[model samples]
Target: MAGHHSIDYTSITAPYKELCMKGKGLGHLKNARGLSIEPVTGMIYVVEGGNTRIQVFSPEGSHQFILHPKFAKWGRVDLWGICINDGIVYVSDYQGGRIFLYTLDGDIITVFAKGFTTNKKMIIKMQQPMGIAINQKGDIYVCEFGANCILILENDSNNHIQTFHYQSPLSIVLRKDGSFIGSKGNLIYGKKTSAIESNQMIYEGIWATLCWFGDFDSNGNIFMSDMKGHQILIYETSSGRPTLLHIIKMTFVGSPMGIAVDRNGRIICVTDSKLHFFKGNTKAISMYS
Candidate 1:
C-alpha cells in the first residue's frame, strides 16, 4: 500500500478549470461557497452565496442551469456545505440552521434536519451548522459550528442519535467503515468511538483562521481547504493518524472555502469568487489508483 512517505509531491500539478465571472446570462459567480460533484452525471454544483442560488456546470466547465431553491423566496439565505448522496442533494443553511433535501431538478423533498433543543428552554440550539455528511445507514452528521460539536440525526427521523464535542468543527467526511474526520481550528481530528483514546488529532499548526471544508479522494486521502491560509492541506489517513502528504498552495484563489475530490480523483476547490481544479501527474496516479 502506498503511504505518504512513498509518494512524490514534486510531480503533483493542479491545473485549474476556470469557473470565474463570465458576465450576465453566462452564469457569473459571486461569493461562491459550497461545492459538490455528481460522479454519475459528471456535473458540478456551486452554491453562490451572493446570488442565493446553486449553479450547475458541465464536465467541461460550461454553465448548464441554476437551482433557485424555494427558500430563496422566503428571504435572505446564507448557504454552505453541499453534498449529493444517492439522488438527493443536501445543502446546509448557515443562517437558518437547517438542512434542505432536494431532487436533482431542484424539487424540495423536505427539510431534512434542523436545530433541535436538548431541553425545553430552547436556549442552546444546534445553531450555525456548516459541513455535512451522510453515513451508510442514511444518518446525517452535521458540524454544528455554534454548538462546537457534530450532531447526528438518525435516518428518516428527527431523533438525535449522538453528539461529539469539538472546538468549532467546520467540515466532516465519513468513511466506508464508519470512521470519520472533521476539521476544527487548525487541526483535523478522527473519531471512531466514544472513548477519548479512539480520537486522534491529525494535523496541527494549520496557520489559518479556520479550516473551511474537506473531502476524501478515491484513495482515502483527505483534502482540507484552509480559508485564511489560502491553501489545501492533503493528508494521508492511516490507523486514525493522518500524515501530511502535500500542501496545495492556492495563491490564485482568494478565501478558499470548499474542497471536493471527484470520482476521477480530480480536486475541485471553491473560493469566495473562483473555482480551482487540480490533477496529479501520470506517475502520481498510481498512488491514488
Candidate 2:
C-alpha cells in the first residue's frame, strides 16, 4: 500500500438488501455507542450511555438478552466500547477511564486496565475510548478518543503492553500481524513506530468524526462507516484507494457507529437507533466492478 491513498466515491456498493430496523423497548438509549460480535456464540452486543445498558442479539437478529441496565449505580454514565471473548464481555467506561468485565449473563466479574496515563507522566484522560478489538491471541487493542492512541492490554495479566498513538484515533482494527488499521480523519495502516509518522489522508471532502468503525472481510477488504458523510467506505487491502460502497440517510438513532463481519461475510452495523446487517451475495467484488 502507498503512504497515502485517495477515495473514489462513485465505484462502491450501496444500500445492502437485508435491512432490518429493530426497537424492542431499549428505553432511552442516548447513542448506540459501541458494538462487537462474539465469534464463539455468534451473538451481537450493543451499548448505550444514558440508559447505561448492554443489549445482545443472536446472529439471526433475534433479541437474546440485555445486561447492566443499572450500570449508572456503578458510578459510570459514559459507557463505550464493547467486545466479547469466550462468552465474557468487556466494556470501557469513557468517564471512569476503566474497563468493566462481565459474564455473558450480565454479571460483573472484574475490571481491568483502569486509569491509563501517557508518557508525558500526566494521567491520560480518555474522553471516549470507543474502539476495541481482541485478536486470536487474546490481546485487547483499545482506542481512546481523548488520548488519540491505541493501548494494547495483555488479556491475562491485564498489564499495559504498549500504546500506539495517532492523530485523534477514533477506532482501531488489529490485523493478524502486529500492525493495525486506525481511523481518525482517514483510514491508516502501519506498525507502531511507522504508524506515528504515517499520516495519510485516505478520504477527502468528508468530515471524519467518531462515526468511523471498521472490520476486515474474508478477502482482506476493509469496510468502514463514515458517520459525518453518511456513507460506508471500503478499501482494498492491496491498493489503499477507498470506494464509497454505500450511502444511507442518517436517522436520529442511526449514526452508523460500529461495524463487524460474521463468518458468512455479512456486514453488521450499529447505528444510534438500530442495528443494520447487510449480506452481499457477490464474492468480494471490487467497487469499480
Candidate 3:
C-alpha cells in the first residue's frame, strides 16, 4: 500500500454498509472498549471494559481466536486502550494502573507497572493508563487519565521522556511525523508531539464530539469514534484547517468505544462486544499497513 494522493479524503458520498452486526465473534464482548488492527494481516484485536480475555478477529470480521491472559492476577480488569506493533499486542489496564504486552500467540512478554523512571532518573508512577500508542521507533505514549497528562515512555517502555498536560484525554492517535490527535471531554484535536510550550495545536475538534480510540489511514486521513453522540467522524488535516470528510451515525452505536481502520480502508467501530465494518469512499492503504 502506497500513498493515496488521488482519492479525496474529505467526503464520503456513499453510505457505509454494515459488515459485522450479527456476527459470531462478538458474543463475549462486554463493553468492548479497546481495539487494534494488525498492520500486516489486518486482524482485529479487542478487549473489554469488563474482566475478560482478549479477542482476535479476521479481516472479514470472523471470530478467530480468544487469547487468555493472566486474568486471575487482576481482581477486576478495566482495559481501556489496545495497540498492535509488528506482531506484539499491547493493552493498557485502567483499573490495574499498568500495561501488558503479549505475543501474537498469546505468550506473555512483559508488564509495565508503577515505579517507572524518567530520563533524568526521576521516578514517576503512571495512573490510570487509558490510551496506548506505539510508534515505529517502539516508543509508548500513554494517556495517564488519573494524572491528567500524556506520558511519553521510551521505546522499551522502561522509563519516561516527557509529559504533556492534557485535560483528561480518553484516547490519542500518533502520526509518523511526530504529531498526534488527542481528546478532552467531548472533543478530539491534534497537537505536535513536543514539549508543552512548543506544542502546536492543529485545529481542535471541528465539532462537539467525544472520541474513544482514533487512527490514521495511509492517506493521512483520521478516524475517530463519538460514543456519546453515536457517530464516527472522519477528517483530513492537510489543508490549513481540518476538513470534515464524513459523519457515520448509526442507531446501534451503543456507546461506540474504539475506532480502527484496516489496510483496505475498512473502518471498524466497537460497542458492547459488537464490531461494525464499513468501506469508506476510498479504500486506500493505511500507514501501519
Candidate 4:
C-alpha cells in the first residue's frame, strides 16, 4: 500500500450489491475455474470447474455448501486451484493429479500431493495440477500442468520439493521479477519458498489469455485472470517487484477466470457462467450529503 497505488475505476461497483452469484444448480456457477476466501469466515470458496463441484458461499452471497469431492479411492473431481490455509482447503485436481485437503465444512483432509519424478529419476505420472499458490509460509504453489513446472508442497509434506522448470507455454501461473511464479514438469520431495535465487527470473512474457488462477491479497496484491484479455490484472508486491496495480475491464460473457480477494478488499471473480462482484474502491458519499 505504498508508492504507486491507484484504482478508483469510478469507485468500482459491479454486480456487488453485497456480492452476487449466478447460474446453474445448487449454489450456481458453471465452467468456473477457482476462488478462495475464508480469512476467518468471510466464507466464499467456489471453484465449479464445469460443475465438478465445490461451492460454499456467504460473504453475503448466502448458500453455504455444495461440495462433491468423491472417494472410493479418488474417482471424481476436476477442479482447478483454490486456497485458504489455516482452516485447510487447498484444492486442485485438473483431471485428478491430486491436491485436495478440505475441512472448512467439506471434510476430506488428505492426498495433498501427487506424481512427479523424472530427469533420469523416472516413475511417477498423472500430474496435471493447475494453479494453486499459498505463501504466508505454507508454501504450496503448484501448476504442474502435466509437468510443464512449478510444484512445491513443503511443510504440509507429501514428498516433491523445489522445482521451477518452465516451458510454461501458457496458463495456470506465471509472472516474473516482481514474484508470483509456474510449469512443464520435474520436481519431487517438495517444500520451498525462500530459495529460488540464482538471478531468479524466468517466467517471462505471457501473463494471460487463459491463465486461470492466482489470488493473493493480504497486501502483496496480485489478483490475476485474463481469459482472452477480458481483464483483471492488479499486481503490487510493494516494491519487492510485481507493479502494475490495476486493470479490471470486465465485459465477460464467459471466459473471465477465477480470482478472489477479501479480507475487506473484496473482488470475487469467476466466469463462463457468472459470479462477478467488486465493491472495494470506496469513498463516494459526498453526492450532496
Candidate 5:
C-alpha cells in the first residue's frame, strides 16, 4: 500500500456535508463542541456548549432530535465532549466537572465521577472532565485537563477505578490493551503508567495553542483535531515516531474541535458552530472503501 505514494491527495478538500438547523424556529448550533457517531445506527451525536444540549442527526445529515442531560432539568449549562458506545451515549459537563450517561433515545441513566471519594466522603476533586473515550470493556476514560491526568470509570457504575497523571492532558485515546495516548500542552505522548514520570514521549509540537480531541481508525491512524492549527493531524500508529500521514485542512471551520471516524471510514469533525465530514486517502481508509 505504501508503494502507491504517488497519489496526490491535496485534491481531498471540503467536507461532504455541513450540518446546521434549517427549519422555522429550528435553532442553529452556536459554539458547538464535541461529536460522535453510532456505528450501528449511523447516528451523529453532537454536544453544543452554547445551546447546552446534544443534537442527534441521521446518517444522511438530517436533524433528528435533541438530547438534554437530566441535569438540564436542574439548570446545568454548557455540554462539552460526547461519545457513543453500543447503545449508550456519554457526554461531558464541560463546566460542571462531571460526566453523564444516557440512552441513545436520550434517557438519563445516571451521573458520576464528579470527583473522587473514599469511604463515601468526597476527598479528591476533579477540576474538569473534558475529552473522553470508551473501550470495549465498557470502561470510560476521561481527561481531567484542569488536574493534568486521566481517570478510568466503569460504564455500569460510573466509579473511578483508575487514574493516570500527565502534564495538563487535554485529550485522551485508549488502546484495547489498556495503554493510552494523551495530548499534553503541544505534545502527544503514550503512557503505560498512571505516573507522569513514566511517559513514553511519542510526538511533539502537534498544536500551536491547544490539541483538543482525537480518535483511532481501524487502520491504526490517529486523527486529532487541532483547534489552534485549524486542521486534523493524522499519525501512523505503527511508526516509532508516528509518521504524519495527512492533514485534513478545515477551511469552513477554522477552529476544529471534536473528531470521530464512522464505521464507514468517514471522518466527522465539528467546530464552534458547524459539523463537517471527510474521506481521507490513508491506506486503511483506502482499504475501508
Candidate 6:
C-alpha cells in the first residue's frame, strides 16, 4: 500500500478486452476525459473534451455507438464526470455550467441541474460544474470546480436541496445511507458528525485535481483515483486511511480521472486517452487488508 504495485494484464477478462489495444480506432476519443460503466449492461461510456460527445461501448469493449446532441449549441461542453442510474445517465459539463441528462441510448433528455452562484442573497449564476453522482433515491450531487463547492439537486423538483462549500470540490459520491463522501483540494471530507460536518481528512498532499473519480467497495472502503499521483488509493470507510492499491502506467495516459466499480466489484478507470480495468481479487484484497 505504500509504493507502486504492478498488475498482471494476462489474467484480465472482459467482453472488450481485445479492443483495448492501442490505436484500435476508438472513434472520436481524442482527449477522452471522464468515464462510467453501466452496472446492469456493463456498457462503457466515455466523454471526450475535444469532440464534446459521449461514446458508448458494449460490455465486451466493442463500439456500440456515439452519443451527441443533434444540433447542439452549447459552447465549450467539456464533460468531466458521469454516472448511470436506473435508465438515465448524468453528465457534468465543466464549460457549459450545467448537468445534462441522457437516456441509456444516448438521447439528450434534459438538463438535470444548472450551476449557480450565490452571495449573501443567494442568487444563482452558472459556473464550472464538474463531477456528478446519483444515489439510489435519484438525487444528483454535482461538484462545481469554479465555485469550489458541492450542490445537491432534487430529482423531480430541480431545486437546490443542499450545498456543501469547500476548497475546490472536484468529485462527490452519495453513499447508501443519508451521508456522502467527497474529495476537495487534496482532502477527502465526509459527513462524520451527521448534520454534514467535515471532520475527516482521508489523505493529504494529493494534487488539487487528485480525486477525479471515486466509488465504495462491498467492504465499504472507498477507492479514488489520484490524477497527479498517477495511482488509485483505497481508504477505509470508517477511518479514511489510504492504502495504495494499484498504479496504472500505460501508453498515452498521464492523468487518471473517472472511476467506477461494477457489480462484481471490479475497478474500471478512465484516463485522458485509455480505459483500463482490473480484476477485483487478491490484488485489491492485499492492498486493503
The candidate that achieves the highest lDDT relative to the unseen native structure: 3
Q: Rate the local accuracy (lDDT) of all candidates.
A: 0.75, 0.66, 0.76, 0.63, 0.73, 0.67
Compared with the true structure, what per-residue lDDT tens digits does model 3 show for residues 221-274?
888888777777887767856687777776763767888877777778788757
Clashes of each: 0, 3, 2, 18, 0, 4
Better of 1 and 2 by TM-score: 1
TM-score of each: 0.85, 0.76, 0.86, 0.35, 0.83, 0.79
- Per-residue alpha-carbon lDDT of model 1 for 188-251, expressed as tens digits? 7777743435554344443444687888876678888888777778877665467777887766
In model 1, the runs with Cα more than 4 Å from the true position are: 1-10, 22-25, 112-124, 193-209, 284-289
Q: Per-residue alpha-carbon lDDT of model 4 for 95-123, expressed as tens digits?
A: 76888887887788787654656444754
**Consecutive 10-residue window with the lowest summed lDDT within model 5:** 2-11
Pairs of residues at least 3 apart in sequence or in different chains that clash in candidate 5:
none
Every candidate's CA RMSD: 4.1, 6.3, 4.4, 15.3, 4.4, 6.0
Q: Would you give me the overall lDDT of model 1?
A: 0.75
Q: How many steric clashes does model 2 contain?
A: 3
TM-score of 1: 0.85
The residue ranges of model 4 lying beyond 4 angstroms of the native Cα positions read 1-5, 8-15, 18-27, 30-46, 53-75, 82-95, 98-117, 120-124, 127-162, 165-172, 176-220, 224-235, 241-266, 270-276, 279-289
Residues 140-160 of candidate 2: C-alpha lDDT, one tens digit per residue: 878877777777778877766
Q: What value does the lDDT take at residue 280 in candidate 3?
A: 44
Residue ranges of candidate 2 with Cα displaced over 4 Å? 1-30, 116-127, 186-189, 192-211, 240-253, 283-289
Q: List candidate 5 stretches off by more than 4 Å.
A: 1-11, 21-27, 117-122, 193-209, 281-289
Compared with the true structure, model 3 gives a TM-score of 0.86
Over the full model, what C-alpha lDDT does candidate 6 score relative to the true structure?
0.67
By TM-score, the best candidate is: 3
